[model samples]
Target: MATTKSSSYHHGDLRHAVLTAALEVIATEGPGALSLRDLARRAGVSHAAPAHHFKDRTGLLTAIAAEGFDLLADALADAPDLRERGVRYVRFGVEHPAHFQVMFLPDLLRGDDAALLAARARAGGELRAGVTGMPEGGRGDDARLAGIAAWSLAHGFATLLLSENLREPVGERDPEEIFRALAELLF
Candidate 1:
């Protein structure tokens, strides 16, 4: 017998269960492997249960993306300084690899989603705040250029770390530590 949507999972929070399962799958196998059916199975819910929370795969990824940006925005807002902001960014990426992966890949998201747009703008604004007074010379676009540079440095470093491309170069060093040392040269 198949589990009923409402009674399948012991917990009533089926949405959370399904989302948690989706994150686990994305974390281990990448977003490409995410499927509503798989998520429902992982959550021990009825096959149609996930659809109640997320209409489809795109809906699932969009929810994750929106929530991830909100998380990032919160982290960035709490940083005391530029270096800390960069560190927080890297930490957020490392800790939430699945979200980090899906966030930047616009193709996987509903670009016009109000929640996603608001969250993206919030995170982007926070990042720009960190670079508004930068010293980079960019033909009257210093702040713009600075934001791009800062984002690139932090994001690229985080991507490398997450992909395990820095294991040899970093030699088991904590990501925040390596980042601090590297950031000292620029910031």
Candidate 2:
């Protein structure tokens, strides 16, 4: 059963509905296909409703990126080690492809949104925290480099897996299992 525009929605429900519809649009068609009018139609609201909530397309994308980073932070929070964190990162990317796509593309979002910046910082902090071998004093340049390498590895692998670029080599194996093997080799 799909939620329709005629469905009675409370104060905040419409905003949530619009965001949900936008994510669906991104998932099925890609972010390039996203439009406030289309999302309004999908959410059973007037074409202007999305604009009222988001102000503009960039506003909507900023919200999505912020939400995505928050979700990523939560997903990575419980991992016990660098390898497990990398596994979680890959899993998050696979599970939330739409969010993953929007979260990283700076050109599509309002980079100065305070909430978005905070959320992104939190996610970055989590990623850095995963590099447990850092020296005790403070995260030196080496730790920063190591974190970047780990993030690149997980993000690259996840992107390749999602695009089916690695299908031949990864056939029949769960992405997480493959990620774990790779993580062990690297970290």
Candidate 3:
């Protein structure tokens, strides 16, 4: 493995490679199984290679969470309406289950990492935009409350679907459609 990837340690995109490997591991084994040494093995680099980018496990988790929030912000921005935001939110969770698993767990992240904070704030702003679009409500407290409600619905439904708790009840129907229907009814 070292012979095959000797050049990678010196020339390849080491940070991205390790991050992808870490995400793959998380997808299969959950975050508890994540280790810099394991990630290095998966990426075919020396065990210390990951540390150059992430410093430690907490740093790696923080980077993953930061990336997740950025992706979420992009997804929410692409959505056409508040209902669609909820739909896309669920879709994002389903599509990026590894990121979904680690993104919101504050205890698993550095919490105050600048990139994480900025990415989280960006995602938060996108979610708030959905509520701000509500014509009936004024700004400030009304918008804040509505944003909370909207986020609660999307996040709760996404969490349920990820846990497969909704599979039996939701059956084979598209979860995005189900979430759209639920959002329509509740909102």
Q: Which pairs, if any, clash in model 2?
A: 5-44
Worst 10 residues of 3 by lDDT: 1-10
Put down candidate 2 lDDT per residue, 63-107, tens digits, no spaces. Answer: 999999999999999678788888999999989998999999999
Residue pairs in collision within model 1: none
Per-model TM-score, in order, reads 0.89, 0.92, 0.92
| TM-score, prediction 2 | 0.92
Clashes of 1: 0
Off by over 4 Å in 2: 8-11, 133-141
What RMSD does each model have against the real structure? 3.4, 2.5, 2.5
**What is each predicted model's overall lDDT from 0 to 1?**
0.84, 0.86, 0.86
TM-score of 3: 0.92
Separately for all candidates shown, the number of backbone clashes (residues 3 or more apart, or on different chains) is: 0, 1, 0
